[model samples]
Target: ISSLRDRITTLNSRPALDPIRIGLFGSSGAGKSTVLNTILGKHFFLPVSGMHTCTSCQVHVSVCKSRYYEAKIFLLSHEEWKEEVKNLLMLVESRHKNDETDNDLEHAIKALKAIYGEGAEEKSYEDLMKTVPEVTIPPSRVITLKKTEAQDLASELDPYIRNQDGVVNSSPQREQMQLWPLIKQVQVTLPPSDLVPEGVIFVDIPGTGDANKKRDEMWKESILQCTSIWIVADVERAIGARAHEIMVQEAINACQVGKCSDITFVVTKMDKIEVEEYVRNHQGAMGNITQHTAILETKRDLKIRKTRALKEKMMLRLPSDAEVLQKQDMVFTVSAKEYWNFTVLTREETEIPKLRDHIRKLYLDMKRNQLHDYLQEILGVFSLVQAYHSTQLSQDPPMRQEELQSCLSGKIEALKAVTTLCFSQMDGLLLKGVQSARNTHKRNIEKILM
Candidate 1:
């Protein structure tokens, strides 16, 4: 009776609610941060450094009830920090040996100096290894600030979150610097009105193609946790061979074998393309083609061509499961910079709102599905409890035992039937979805191959 009551208590308790996560994944400097900033309508909070800025995965969320900004940073273990220090020192030494004209190399040296002091350049590899902490502490720490206005909050969070200029040498900045190199994760919660929903998380992950193995594992973990994934890129580089390879290697390859859902492709930096120049170069005549007219016509032509090219490239790369790729309205062109600038030409043209809507709907759908599954499990538990109760109420012991055994067998058979039926339905649905994706892929491939 106690065990049965405990089982009932377990069934009645609410299950843990995991937040919906969306992952923005792509190559370094691929305008991924821009896409996220645009989505959140926040500026400069997420560091938009050109080269390997995001070294670890950062998950951003919003707390509707809280008025202040909060950041929970998860630092790496001492061993991990030592490894990161080794990598940074090696890069700095290599830069010192290599070309003196490279600005990136200069930035790397300055960043290293900013963290390790002036002598950082002269430190031997073994000396740098010894510089790491002798003891290991808990891998995470939290920092909270009284909530300020959106713009102000964004500015304040910059030092704590930004990659390029985040590290400083002040006495109080020691902990921040020590943790920055080994930061495995950063969780930031904004105010209620921020673009981040109360129960949904947006993860900003470093590119998987980097040399850091720990961070690469974090990137893979982020992908596994995400409910939706967006592969962001600059419009000029969207369908490039490297872009295709990354998408296939990081996303499509997973979808081919795993329970992968839809993946969206976002082409950012649309404003960078000079429509008039493209029109002049590609079209037969550019004379008398008014700027606005040329811009409209060129954008239309470019979208059409890019879409075709993207489909062809993806199909070629994912020949076996091309259609699954096509099922998603995967291509989105955006100009996050222009959207924030609010210029006449760029104002209503930004598709950030459309993407936002898609995410909102996806979140709702996920909630509904979760609720359905939960209710199904609850019903099963209730039915089992009901059978146990019915058996307990019977007065005739021997007859009741036989009756209970029969009842148990019937219940087991019924449960098996339900399980088989559910599996069959799911299999049918999965097959149908795959077939639809394949059909879409085939149609797009036909258009391109012909």
Candidate 2:
């Protein structure tokens, strides 16, 4: 019984961040997906470039001993589904009345029409509210895919991720199934590799450009659970006002003030930045170089200048009151496309490999911390138990009935105090979480409604 009790205590003391969560957040076209692809060494999560994709969160976990790829989908709740349908109906009505075109709204209508037939698009607000059945989304789902069938499966899953029926022949179908909006989250499990650390989950959050209220709330909630965060941004535009606000103003708050160590700022698409003008303007002795040398010299100079500029810009923009900003590493500039394609020789200044190394180190540190915590808990538990056992064993003729009763009473009182304290702490934490979630939901509603 004592052994069983010890095992139970060990299980109870397990750390929450066992599978360390690394969250990725950025605006659309910021190369977040590209960074994700580079990290994974494969294009597992599809990137919806130049467009806002679905707001559903995508979680990628590495599955060991699984030879094939797999996915588990979590759909939105019934209330969320109804809210989406009503919003689409309202959007269509408003757009039609004003003779204004909204591709997103129209795309939604078409997807619904495909799923529920022609009446889906033509239904009035009241009719939709009455006719639409309450959707019962499963708590969890699992899908398996052979290596060869992964791409085909991704195509099938595109509508769910994109929140719209994919384009057909460069034109979207008027009546095609779109399941993306109905999904609250997706879990993609791939075979374990160097890119995916064991017992780590990578989260890809949709850009803030998405207008969905429910999705926005989910995004905020996910941030609270993350152990680390990566803020991906376009290299040229990363220091701009909007990106700065997101990184310095909002993301800092979302990651929790004291708990998080630092936020990693990843400036992506470095290859896209034109350096010809900078090269010509400040070439100095490096001028009159050959085409190859000029390109290399130009890239080198631009990288040094941009890196310094971005660092200075971030230092200026970061809140003086927030000490977390000072702990972060200097900005990392990378071209995921160039790295993936191996078109250009990767330089240390780009820092893609360095980022990977840092992630590995972070994982090791987290595991070491977890092990230390587990050891401390086990040691404390065993020490108390051993001391209690020794006291009982050393008792002369066992204690008298009155003495025993007094000892039992003291122990009971101590246990009661500990239990009460635990419950009180739990209650306070829970209440704070509830309040935070409520505030987040309220803000999302106001943003959407406005």
Candidate 3:
């Protein structure tokens, strides 16, 4: 009985399987959101316009087991908000003192306006600090919508996740507050699909070059948690110096520490090429083929050439120590708009389906490994039970009742000692964590005030 109990305890104490997270990264206007939407077969993420992004914080999407589309929005704690506001105020003050460039000032003011109201930066520091307490930050919330109400989820989350275009003030007559500035992250759960399985999480990270220090920390943390990283870029600029710098200088180290072996460089907007201009530029390669055939052949050749060139560039620019960049098929040129519109390119040509297959393969591989581990655990337990029964049957007199009781009592005492030790260790760790957090918070407050 004791042996069986030990086996059961061991099995129960095994950690739960963690979901496989794929982090999506890109510069602003790189169509990272569009790529995610294409892969998921749903327009869940709002695609923004040129030089701007709609995702203000990390947006994690996974398959929901239930019938409803659910969203959980995590809000920044009061201390975090206070620290960020103080930093912004200092930047604004520095700008005023030095008459520096307006870029930093503009960003700080925009963030302040998002949190408070329009013209928030014009106020004095004391006045702005007073409003911080009265701003009434919304608590983290979960919003669920039925399948019929799926279309409304975006609008519901807009205030929390989307970065609005212009400075919009809160209405004085109503209780309307823009919550995007306060949101730390958003988790969206969609109905289960074959393409995206339950244990695969797609994290849409904000642009890597964000000015906010808090956001920069989040980007690094998100990269650390990912099993795979996808870097999205415009097809035309996919191999540009900026893209090279970001991948080689900024992202490679985090990916290495995370032990993420899969890194995909996706160049989007492949269908934006002018066919006639391309054909004219490559007339020697086009030969004397008919116009219709020349166009088709030209597109195929261009895609192949671009894909090869991008892959080579990555291999050369990436450090030789980077295992993630070693794969031959790491680069993909896709057109999300063309895939959805189905105008000129075929579904296969668009490459969205191929990307979906890649994700599905990852999910299937993870599930297989988990299932294997579960089976091994079950077999281990079964062996323990069989050995216990065999030992009992081999006893000459089946053991006296007092002897059996004595054995059980000894096992029970051992278990009690083990449990006590575990609890003690856990309590110590918990107390240590609390003290560390308190010290860090105190230091941050002092720095901001000073």
Candidate 4:
């Protein structure tokens, strides 16, 4: 019983960052997915280049200093939420490999009937999921429905459905699905970082260039709500002009002063350049990683060199005929080559050794490492979820409140891990800082008082 209480204590503790949700937004080839994949400790999103691919926003439970896997719900207004929800449902259903063909359509029809019930009003999938959190989402069979179905479905499933008839390839629906990925993409999960005590959920908007002026403006409005904004400027292409900045400014201007403070800058592509000073305000970061002066100076040099590299990369793309005002923000130069270095290199898959080899040879981990650090800190935790989801609506249902608290405690152990890593640098300092490993055991004093 005591052990259970202790576990609950650990899991319930609040992480360092604010528990509110967050999103990550930028243009194409911006390493947004790469950044997220690194923080999640999994190679989930496609890191393809040149063209924009991510259409719908994805959400996961991001937790820091907390032990349990965080569970997040992507809430969308009644009329405003359909497309994004459909995208999620499609993906979730796809994971089970359920086809959208005739057979699958039959299956979906069955699913719909099971939840909405016999002689129920003809409702669309959107209508059904909207009731998930309120508990009307029945099993594949019958379920004691409730008013909270939408919230429930939003937590476990994302709805990017195709049609009422389960039509997979309705051209109009397909186009809508295509548009789906670019929707307000939200990531709901424990952030794989440690710096953000509370955790962060990055809502990535679709590429601004891919959307119309109005849509792009909408994207910015969404980004303005995030804890930070990371703009992705291609190293080999346009760095955007003052007009683009105006759009970003317009959205940012509307946000609270504190919200604006959450933004950060990232310049993609380090593998393509060699010169450092042309991009930096300083040349101090170029020493060796092993020497004291070398380590300190090299670290500094690396930072300046990388920032300079980003500026140069962006500058290289600015039209010689076009003058774009520069924005001063911390930038880390990176490359697709470097991105894989940070993520895939650590885990060599049997089938993709070649890709890993290519990224490793280019020495791109330097950039990847910093991005990893930034994400490691901003992961969001699910602290108030139990309060929000107390009643069980499914068989496997949500985690018990006690169990959720235990997960939080488990995550807090990472702080000790980070401290230990730093101590390795200070010789015995890391070891000396550890607490004694002792468990309490009460002694009985029955016959004699000591």
Candidate 5:
């Protein structure tokens, strides 16, 4: 016990400081709000404005699950289309009517009133009403567009999604990814800030809000600041819808922007979505998302067929190769809470041991630091320089001395920079500890699939 205490004291000496900042973005109904509430272990997001209970850029707040650096990002989605499209149509129609009334002063809507004399405008309108009763107007029939037109649009859009530049193919490729685990990384706080001063501020923005080129740019801008990204993929829809195709691109774009260099896939609401689970077997599960998705397609179920096609063709098309390495960064499968962990964890964060283990894997991966890589580089360089001295002749002392002095000077400068950043002056010399807690949870997802 004494030896254990000494070892524990060594590792636990530092307080968790670097805030793990996470940015959760997805299409509306991707369950961003639900995930937050789950993390908080309660319905802490009742006021998440918008028609879909979305959050709107709420900043540096504490979590309801447990106290920590928390924030919510709210962005609109295609689901808001019902209202926006309606508004756009009304505005266009109103403008058109006003344009017609501006023809001339004499024939203008109001001018006609004077022509009819005093209250003639009202009288004329009443007469018109009598002829075509204003009691109630028939509902405007939605002008159904041609399916051919939609197909044409999709055809034009197909080329963009089919790019095979980085789609995953091999297991090694998937392992190279750093962002895959970020999704599974259980974030009790939106930003991993509970333990670190340098935590991420989540801008829980939905990717669907961007309708045009400009809005798209804004969406990209927001995610670029994230230390990590949790891209929500709906279990029901996955990346099946046309709108989701755009979001898929947005996720790719988030990686492109170099925001945090890590991305996690948040497969949302699996408990309520059936299509993905009947896949009792996937060969590529030993291979990759693409190959396994293909394996899923052979399943006898039609809905699973849709799921397989999307997961294989659409969902992981980007990570077909290069994207797997990105997946290695972070990724997660999450359902809104149906169970509560009344002990130290919140209900939202508690889950079957399998799910918890998967999330733990993601967290361990994301919490990775470049310290090892840095040390390797430093030692390699030092060894090379020393080896050069051993190989060189001491007889050419003058020239060799000067070159050695110059190299030493440069190396010394680099070391100084490293020393300055090592945070030696901080109290108790405790500036370098990362949080590590392995959450073991196991549960079958068969019921959700059924």
Candidate 6:
């Protein structure tokens, strides 16, 4: 009976369901923020300059429940901030002594400057620690906009979430205390939109390669929590060695630990190609086509070739058990700029709508599965209770108490067997259906291309 009570307690203690998190990752100039903005159907996230990353920490964007735009900025504790400063100073000192490559030192210096004004790296560790109390411990971490426009919300969030760009902050106090470098993460809530489904969160994760160990670990933990991951890169450099390294080496390592079910490779800036140069190089491919037709055809052809190449690389690098590369429609070549500007590509040609639909479908599917699992657990508990009550109410219970206990044990084992068999059968049918759908989808895409 105690064992049964423990089991009941465990079931009752199950945590509340969290929204399905879709993590988007890319290097500094990979157009990750642009892709997220396009998906949200607004310019919510500020696009970073080519030189630096604005997303120093994870930014979780979800549909808001209330009228106002809400932002909860989580900050590092005082002790945590102190340790982080120490680590950055160590990196800077190591760079000076060893005369190593400047990448680590540069990032460290930028972080220090963002926290303390310019020329912060020159300060000793003790001096830097003294200044930590002024900014590291914020008065309040949450900021909300009262029924403001998207632009207004973006402006309010710029100082807390964005890196120190040349744009001067209107608030001198905000400039004096750069909140972004000290932020652990930022959660932004926006109004409901057709693009972002209910109970779906889009996390814009910075690149995994960071000089900060704490940030790197946070990235890994975030990757493991994602239900789906979108790996973004510039279309021109999607197949470069660095892109592959991040995709196959860093991101894949975390995904392999489970939680992540889908991985899609997105190549942005498809509209930035030089049509004349492309046509001249692929004259045979662009034979007898108008300039407009040639450009569209070139983009389509590049997407196909790049998709094939990416799949081949994944096959070579990924372990045989990996399921990420097995999914159909895993590659998306999108031009967020063209989607909004409509200069060269149509809305459909940009592929943003398709990506948005994919995200919604993932959320719907996850919710459906959660409902099913919840019902299963409920039914299991009911069976256990019914079994116990039925045994207790037996007329011959006094003489056959031992038999009743044995009977109860048998029912429990039978329940477990039934649940296992049902799950196995369901998994088999789902796999078969998914395989058939993938084949049909692949053929349809080929027909459209032809």
lDDT agreement with native, every candidate: 0.64, 0.62, 0.70, 0.41, 0.41, 0.73
Best by lDDT: 6
Output the better candidate (3/5) by TM-score: 3
TM-score of each: 0.67, 0.68, 0.70, 0.38, 0.40, 0.76
lDDT, candidate 4, 1-450, per-residue tens: 455455456545733224333454566455555554443444443233344344334443354543333333333444444554453345436635654444433333333333344322244455656553312222322112122233443323323311123334444434333223223333343423432333344454545553333334456556545544455554433244443364345434423433433233444443443334332423554433222233233334545764564445444544333212133434433444443564322222211233223223222322344356445433322333343354544557778799988988888888889888887778665444442222212233432455
lDDT of 2 at 360: 81
lDDT of 6 by residue, 1-450 (tens): 676787678667865455888888776678888888889888455545567666666788899666667777787777777898888899889977898856667767877887776778899988987764325454564444444577777766767666554545566646533666677888888888778876888898776555555554565567777888778878667766474455645556555675776777888888877767666878575545555566577567766876677567666757756666766677788888888888777899889999988887778767886778877877887798888888889876465678889999999999999999999999999999999998799889999999
Candidate 1, lDDT over the whole model: 0.64
lDDT of 3 by residue, 377-432 (tens): 88988997887788878947577799999999999999999999999999999999
* 1 versus 3: better lDDT goes to: 3
Runs with alpha carbons beyond 4 Å of true place in candidate 3:
1-16, 43-47, 118-129, 132-136, 139-148, 167-177, 209-218, 248-251, 287-328, 368-450
TM-score winner: 6
lDDT of 1 by residue, 35-100 (tens): 887787776666676655553457565445677676666666656656766666667677668745
Task: Report model 6's TM-score to 2 decimal places.
Answer: 0.76
Kindly indicate the candidate among 1 and 3 with the higher TM-score: 3
Order by TM-score, highest first: 6, 3, 2, 1, 5, 4
Q: How far is candidate 3 from the true structure (C-alpha RMSD, Å)?
A: 18.4
What TM-score would candidate 5 get against the native?
0.40
TM-score of 2: 0.68
Candidate 2: lDDT of 309? 59
Ranking under lDDT, best-scoring first? 6, 3, 1, 2, 5, 4
Models, CA RMSD each = 12.7, 16.3, 18.4, 24.7, 26.3, 13.4
**Model 2 residue 280 lDDT?**
65
In candidate 4, where is summed lDDT lowest over 10 consecutive residues? Answer: 137-146
